[model samples]
Target: MTDLLLNHRVEGSASAPPLLLGPSLGTSYALWDAVAPELSIGHRVVRWDLPGHGGSAADLIGPGASVGDLAGLVLRLADSLGVARFAYAGVSLGGAVGLHLAVHHPDRVASLAVICSSAHFNGAKPWQERAALVRAEGLAGLAEGANSRWFTAGFTVQRLVQDHREADPEAYAACCDALAAFDLRDRLTEISAPTLLIAGREDPATPPVHLREIADAVPGAALLELPGASHLAPVQCPEAVLTALRTHFDGAAPRGMEVRREVLGDTHVDRAQARQTPFTARFQDFISRYAWGEIWTDPTLSRRERSMITLTALVAHGHYDELAMHVRAARRNGLTPEEIGAVLLQTAVYCGVPAANSAFATAQRVLAEEED
Candidate 1:
């Protein structure tokens, strides 16, 4: 391991919770320029440049490096800053480092957010080829095409492109070697940190499906997909990325909103938010913080079990409208239609036939809508 420290910029009050932001390959911490200041309002935000990418030493890592090596450097940097545990967010290769840390060093990561990154990076053959090309011809060619890979067709961040062009070729190649060797797909289920994933719908490099794969494996993980974004989401859609990060790493209400969106789905939650009034706002906040955040987020009960209990309670009270909504949630929690029917059938014996009858009708309608 290299003893040289990574170059970093710290923001916000030192007393606040520490948040470490990592950059993607070819770009520096400057990639977070649009969003870091706002994040620093409530967090001790530390943005770091990758070795050879910005102000960090090019020799910090050699050609045979791995994502674990990058994560080690980040842990060392955090240790130097007296940050024992922190909320971490990263883009692309930087995101891979976050994944490695969450899997191998869970005690050091309080929470994790992976933006436009994947667990395996498509099996590494492509990264190996890119590493070879960069080693031989340098970053100019890649920088020329950076706009295409990192953003949508007519939306380029000049500073980021220039950072790509100016990156140290040997160090960049070493990063590529790390990417070529990185694969955390099998270890995703082992993550214990509260996790969030943001994906650029337009990103061809590591698309939304990549984020979805991680969300599927990590228990209670949440995902947000940006419509106009590509690989460098924070640069391309700062407001959207900032909002997601805030909700993921902030107070109990924000945490509740994230879990609400995850379990009920975005469309349902968005509609609820839109319909909230001044009189209802407090109630909404209470539900988010108390019911969704504190209750639903409790890991002691699997979401599937919660769905079962919620379904039974709703039926017992003859809350068919709420039952319909939870029917969809039960499906999302991995309950088969037959299993849902079984749950309702059991409820009939205790909740009474009339109540179960209404619930079965509501559930049937909801399940049919899902099939369509």
Candidate 2:
């Protein structure tokens, strides 16, 4: 389709890299609120509400739309933003989206992080039956059983249950149908991005073994088994999730750095390197380690989106020096001349005419020099 209307919010410094966060079927984008603040500090986190949930219309997806179709909707969003590639992380049905993207749209994915999710969530029969039940009785019918399966030992089910209870019945049913049809075990090896697979040992929904199957299939993928955690491990044991993300993103040769060099150019990088004295060394190190290495490398977001965020933040902060560098980077990241003008024009409204004028001046100069 030409456009997808699923509700989404992009937060963090416009200068930060873009990270896409997908919610599970029953919940809204609020599912990531706990971890978003920490992540947003380093990433332009894009939280999207699932279809028929939160701000999305209940019928945003038709009866035939599968997880692959859902992936298509996400890529459409990226295209609209002029984001050439991004990192992605999702839970449950959201995780299935990461899988589909990594398998089918590998070129657009920088990294893939799957949390408390599954490749094939149970057999099709259970999902079909759940879909039928919800269609007949609405989301209220699935609340109790779903709550029981999603958490463990002393964990309160009130909030999680509420997420399901408030869901749109028809949309929930469509998600169930999507799960019923999703099974990508055969194509696991096709995934090219750096991948992180997380599982909750206590999760009955998609147990650790199911996650192990995925881990075993995808070469070089790291699997972290969070002990005593349940299906909602991200909410139940968030620390484990954060730690794993850091380790994955902060590795020796981070995926983010590769994209960074590609976007920023060797001339810029060499200049930055030339100025890295001891005083400036730590400053550069922190950016490379945390900002570029960790946050940028997150398979959960994209490099193109990151360039956009950085450009916007520079405009907002009136940091024309950085803005000029990123203006050049933005083009390399696939922002068209027209698109870059649009970003600056939007900045004029929110940031001010002066900031945008400066940005436009720098961007126009860079575009002209490249043309020459």
Q: What TM-score does model 2 achieve against the real structure?
A: 0.67
lDDT of 2 by residue, 25-49 (tens): 7878877766666666567778888
Q: What local lDDT score does residue 163 receive in model 1, on the 0 to 100 scale?
A: 90
lDDT of 1 by residue, 160-243 (tens): 899999999999999999999988888999999999999999999999999999999999999999999999999988867876
lDDT of each: 0.92, 0.80
C-alpha positional error of residue 315 in candidate 2 after TM-score superposition, expressed in Å: 40
- In model 2, what is the error at residue 2, expressed in angstroms? 9.8
Winning candidate number (lDDT):
1
